[model samples]
Target: MSFFSRMPLFVLLIGVAGLAMLVPAAYAAATAWYEIARSFLFSSVLMLVLTALLGAATAGGRRPGPHGRSVLATMLGVLGVLPIALGLPLAMVLPDTGIFNAWWEMVSCLTTTGASLYAADMLAPPIHLWRALVGWLGGLFILVSAVAVLSPMKVGGFEILSSPYGRSERFRPLPESADPRNQPQFFLGLGADRTTPSARAMRVLRDVGPYYAGLTLALWVILLLAGDPGLVALCRALGTLSTSGISPVAGSVGVHSGVLGEVVVAFFMIFALTRRFWPGGGELRATETLRTDPELRLGLTVVVLVALVLFLRHFFTSFEQEIAASNVATGVLISLRNAAVAAWGGFFNALSFLTTTGWNSVDWQGARSWSGLESPGLLLAGLAIMGGGVATTAGGVKLLRVYALARQSERELERVVHPTSVSGGGRMARRLRSEGAYLAFIFFMLFALSIAVTVLLVSIRPIEFDTAVILSVSALTNTGPLAGTIHLTPSFESTAGFASNPWEGWSGLAALPKTVLAGAMIVGRLETLAILALVTPDFWRR
Candidate 1:
């Protein structure tokens, strides 16, 4: 079959790619960054013209229908084209960055992975705005794709998003008629009368689009109220809830360091990590859905346990030291309050970062000093590795797959002790089989491989193993902050190097290492499975 015959999604992707450029172009004009503005305008025009031509060429062609391959093709095409298109302007406008580095930066932003190669302080206002806008748009694409494409395929840990009524078996939409929609309608087609998969996907998009936009708007307003600059607030609102972590300012959340701001971010980060908030008209109870999900349960438990451990450690060591360091009794009281605030900050910080939102407003060094919090940063790193729910914006090993693997292991252990027992009869066992553990195993293995590759890539740099692990986790999980020392700046230019001069010329990192790190960030954000699935022929075959 012709490539376009098998995959018409390229047309849709071309349109999206064209649309993506307008944001940066607008930002350039608004910020009076003429050089950047010109570059963006030129790039946007080129892309729009080219894509429009291609879209026209591909029009008036009809295929049987879209399959998993078409969906994967669309996703892959968008992922590949978007970065290059956006990067063109950056390479042209930025003082001294190669196309490769620019592409990396653009990919990281678009993937909602906050990894950056550019120093925030060094970037012009237009460029920074461009990055945040791309990140936000990237997040929206992922959210829409998750529900419209990935969920139906039962890939990307989207099993929970599967139709609760088991309408996915034949890959058909739920019947429209309340009475006529019967099980036979599911098994056999309605005698050559049926809605196409593409049609259903479009319907789902139409239904969910408003909810997505509303949530984004709500987040933007909240961030604005938190005293963020207008542009920065919009960026944060989009970045935080999308778990993208891209920021316009140098230090991100740490730049402001307000308690209320951090709290707001923490709440949104939590919201993003969950699948329950996605709007659809249903009797489905959101809280109950979350409660019943093993992954959610495990993720929440891990967060709580880690928070308690860190809190106790901070209260004893850091809090005591801060109190002693103070001269006045009032100073001691102030120190205690600081410690309390910092402890709360650290807890929420870990939670948010683990969920891969990476919003940090608290002073890490001061928190450690005031609360005796030794390496609560490491704890956050660990949580990021653990990750949040499956199919979430958060990256990492994904809690559901981990939970499934753990449960399978436990069941096997029990069966080994009692071979004759009804080991497979349990409700959980039935659920696992129906959900397909083989796929989860494959996902876990792929996740591990990605991490290994990322670690190897980072190891080529001057970073140590522990630091490499942290960086890998941060990038792969889309969780920012390296070693709890590095805050949001996206790239090593701001986060790495000496404390005295963070942006002092990428002093420690060589070109190759920077390149590899950037690549890892892109891979992590798009995710191992999504990319791999695109390449797999099996996904294309009926």
Candidate 2:
């Protein structure tokens, strides 16, 4: 343990990732997939040995405390460089796919993007298990970093709590290595002691890791009981908990567990909507506050609104079609039942995409069929952009930022109507309305800029404008499955194009495009501000 304390976070993460390979290796061995088993075993052993040597060499050095910038760099390394090592076994298993493809796949999984170059049926079950496992670990990594690293840095949604005017003496503007002045008050208020960031991370891991694993285990068991195969249950369970949307059978749409499984998954998806569902999440808030948390309320609102729009849109259209084909009374009853199903489908899909998990509801196709309308692909793209709560597995601009912007808009509108009126919702609300909203607005603009730049870089190839937009948003939002689901082109019959779809999936893309998307995934996971920090001269000089 002391030896490990001296090694950097990146080295430790690599060692853990290597140890994770053992799970797949053991499964492959049990299933008699000997060659695949051998690949994993060899990779695991190689990584562990290298990490051990590195740790020993660092044992005499000063312990690496979790400073904000160093943690950010470590995270970047985990998402970027760790994949090269993690993908070794993947490359060995899929020899035909080049090392770059394997690296891209691992990056997608490690970033919890859930994008895959290989189709659902292309990889062996063990390979899929490895992908899901990597994503699950990635989810844990982000959760820990959000609490320990970003909270102190005030870069993640915690920026909302920063001094509205400037850096309050209470909260420093910049984080420094081992600076006692830079403690994260928001998280520190949650029962965590004023300690180094690394200690806080370890404590968070100890508190949250078991529940995270247990939730995944519990979900996996329930899915199996719901009639899914073991492998499918395990993968979906990991995907759901991680918000990765990874699946052995493509996605939730392909699962055999049916509506029962979707319902169960939906219950667990609430975890992603707000961190309060987990330990250490209710920072500085009263017990009753969880019920009225802004993030939770905003997330639910988005899901319900999106669901209602789709339901109504499809219901009216389906009722008209049914009436033309049947008697009025019969059409009314049939449309009611169809509307119920469509509502459920819309609700489930809306929540899933809102969390940025990218899971398609099983009944989504039925809903589309009832309406005889093209899938509302753009609506999903929008939901993914809204994303889930701060410090959760889901990724996007985040719900808190959106909530802050909304609050600011309301305050602005009130001032417009009555130029001399005092606005109040308590100090927290006031902060959110003022500087929090200011920061949120800046982030929103930066996020949009990232999308435009990514789209521009992607379009340097032969991709169409709409296709480029979808792909860019998908990557930047860390919602990889979006690329395949959204089709901007409409057929002559007013349905999504099947015959002449312009966008090919990830595997069909050129090397340059894939590389650009991979970079976008890392940028999105790290968020823009931290990435900017990496390039700043002051960050290096410090």
Candidate 3:
């Protein structure tokens, strides 16, 4: 602990990331991926040596501070440096690839962005697992940072949500005689009067880290039992937990897991949609439990409502277009079946997008598939816009803030209806409803501005306007697969009632345009608010 705590903060984190990569490296060795194993092993050694050098140099240097700026800087440093280190192996393996492209691939994985520069078939199983593993670890890092570092700073998603609570999670006290800057709270970011920064971080890791690993392991085992291949099952478990929605195989999970497999993935994806499932850092309250959880309620409601609407719409349309059916009974039965499939498709896809996992349903055969009509792409996009819970692995604008906004609007409507009607739930509740809504709205607008800016920038490189828009949204949502271009322009397929995003396979995009989307992915993961807070004059003043 003393040795690690002496290390420069970024160096310590980089060392940890390097160590984590060894898991995949060992796996590569076992699978006869000698080159891959050598690459990772060498990277890990280099990182550790760097850690030693930094630790010795920083031994007499200033310690980490409580200021959110430092925390943000550390985070940005990790996001930038770790990807390059992780991509070292990839850059060596992939022919004709520059360091920038390889780093982009690692950035996508570590950010849980799930955008692929190479098709699954092009990569070995070990390499695919490495990507999934990177995403899974990234999710864990975000979770720990959210609870330990960012939450105290009242940045990350913490700014828009609850106020910081009293009483820090326990740890050993730093010596009273220690430098003021080396106070325990300086590292943890809160008033935790415990051990050194390394010890405090490890304490949090010890308590919460196992749950993440356990959940992924349990799901991985289940998926394997459910008939997915070993590598695929492992990737699926990691992807679902991370909400990266990455698949080891070229085809979707449905292709490998079947209906039963998709069901399992869906069940597990609920964890990403609500923080109630993950062990809570805050005090346990009734509302935070699954029974009364707002995220769960709204998510389920959206899933059910959207599914029903899609099902009924398809049912009626199918029934009306029953020209091929010779018998009335046959026509009715086919319509019923089609509606059932459509409903499930709608439900599965909606929840997936809402959680920002971005998994397409097995039945998403597009507009020209088994049924002549298209599955609704715009509806899926809207759900993606709504996002998942604030603290969870999922990304987007978040449902909690959306619910707050909706409640605020409803309260306003009620006041209009009866001018003297008192709002319920006390003053705190009222404030949360109104102030929370305003912040959420600001975040949304900022998000919109970011999208506009990103699209404009990308379009300057000769990218189509609509493609820029979709790609920007997809990147901002941390739903990389969503950025896969959907055909919107007039074409033969459009004339024949079919559309697909040719850019879905990201490798085909021009290097300059790809860079634009990659930048968006980084900004999205850090989020609109964090970026603003990091750069704000007021924040710096503090």
Candidate 4:
């Protein structure tokens, strides 16, 4: 147990991923699918053997200390190299997907992008479970890394709230009497302690893993009661908690759980909007609570305003036409029902996209029918770009950054009206309005630049501009399902057919573009700043 626990992060992850295959193996065995079962069993054994060899060689070395760079590199490996290792069984089982496609699919799920090359009916139930399980593990990895690694390093979105990068208290020089190499490190951050990186990571998993798994299990049971089949419910629950948006079926359109299921899922989506939902994620200020969280406020505001616009866009037009075509009371009742449906759809869909989960409300079709408009694909993309709260499963620019930018903009406007006005929100508020805002703006701009660069790369495939844009945004936001919702503009021939879906579009792409999108997903998951930090010479010299 000690040797296993002391294994390097990548080795540990590889082993866990190997063990994860047993789930599908067991399922396949129970269902009399021995070929598939053998494939998984063989892969699991191979991975464990590899893990044991690697762990034995490296476990006794100078124990990994609190080196942020190591953690960052492990994360990159988890997103990139680990997927290649994890994809073997998948490639064996899904013969149509070559090793490269299998690797790409695992990359998508591990980064919580949840993009698939196969149609829903193409893979068996066990395969879908594999994808969802991988995604769930990926989500847990993000959470643990966010608090244990990124917070101390002052990278990720924590830069907005932390002292400037490389200047954090955690990075201070060691005392003269103490040999830095011999002493344990103690840094102030969420879940920080006097321990090695691997120990710290395991501690966080122990603390946070249950809540993560329990939430998924609870949601799964509730979804089953709501009418979804067992496997379907389990996948949905895993997808929801992980914000992976993966499923055995299609989007909510493919769900049998109906409006009630959608409602329940939507309620659970709130977890992505704020880190406060988790242990050790509460506000630094005793006075602040979830109700007062700026991220939550900004997220709710965005959802409500976007939903309202979506509802109103077709409400008046559809209402007037219906009233003119029908008798008075009948027209009023029907129009009211349509309005209600549209509102609910807008609200649900808006929340889904904002969290980067990419769930299309089942009533989204009804909303479109009532509003007399195609799905607002561009608008959904915009919401995804806004993303969810910091240190959560969802990805994008993040709500805290957005909130900071908004607060700073408001302050700037006030300054414009009164030259001598002082920002008066207290120390934390002042920090947020000043340094926080500046950092947030920088990240937002970097995020935008990432999208532009990704778009350029994808466009090189000779893909249409609209499709490239959607693909870029989806990949960079870690919101893969967003690519499937491209019905907003009619100009592209890609969206012309009823059978069109993201899988078809993505699968047809040349290898280069697909690889580029995969890289973008890694960038989105790790955030551009962390990647940049890795390349800087000073990071390695230390």
- Regions of model 4 farther than 4 Å from truth: 164-194, 251-254, 281-287, 488-503, 531-542
Kindly report which residue stretches of model 3 are placed more than 4 angstroms away from their true locations once superposed: 163-200, 281-288, 366-368, 488-505, 529-531, 534-542
Each candidate's lDDT (Cα)?
Answer: 0.62, 0.81, 0.72, 0.81
lDDT score for residue 516 of model 1: 65
Instruction: Answer with 3 or 4, whichever has the higher TM-score.
Output: 4
Which is better, 3 or 4, measured by lDDT?
Answer: 4
RMSD values, in order shown? 5.7, 6.0, 6.5, 5.2
What lDDT tens digits, residue by residue, belong to model 2 across residues 1-542?
Answer: 44444567777787898899999999999999999999999999999999988878777877665445676677778889999999999888877776787898899999999877766665788998999999999999988877766665556666666543333323234455555766554323422234544566677788889999999999999999999999989999999999998988854544598899999999899999888877664432312567798888889988999999999999988888899999999999999999998999999999999998988888899999889999888999999999998889999999988988998999889999999999988777887888778878888988998999999997887777887788889988889888767764321221111221223356666777778999999989888857555533334442
In candidate 2, which residue pairs get closer than 3 Å at backbone N, Cα or C atoms, i.e. clash? Answer: none
Residue pairs in clash, model 4: none
Candidate 1 or 2, higher lDDT?
Answer: 2
User: What's the distance in Å from true for residue 474, model 2?
Assistant: 0.6
Best by TM-score: 4
Instruction: Give the runs in model 1 whose Cα sits over 4 Å from its true position.
Output: 1-7, 62-65, 159-202, 252-257, 279-293, 319-336, 363-365, 372-374, 409-429, 433-438, 457-467, 483-515, 530-540
Tens digit of per-residue lDDT, candidate 1, span 1-542: 13433334545555556676677778777777677778878887887787667656655556535466666656665666568777888888754566766776777777777666556666777777778777776776666666555654546665422333544333346656566544544452121323334454455567666876677788778767777777777777778766877777756374553667777777777665555666531211223455675666676777777667766666666545655666668666876676666667567766776787766655544666665435556667667777765555676766766776776677678789987776564444445544445556777677778888878876775565766666666667776544344442223432321121233222235567556666666566556656556544436656
Q: What lDDT is reached at residue 372 by model 3?
A: 68
Instruction: Give the lDDT of residue 450 in candidate 3.
Output: 91
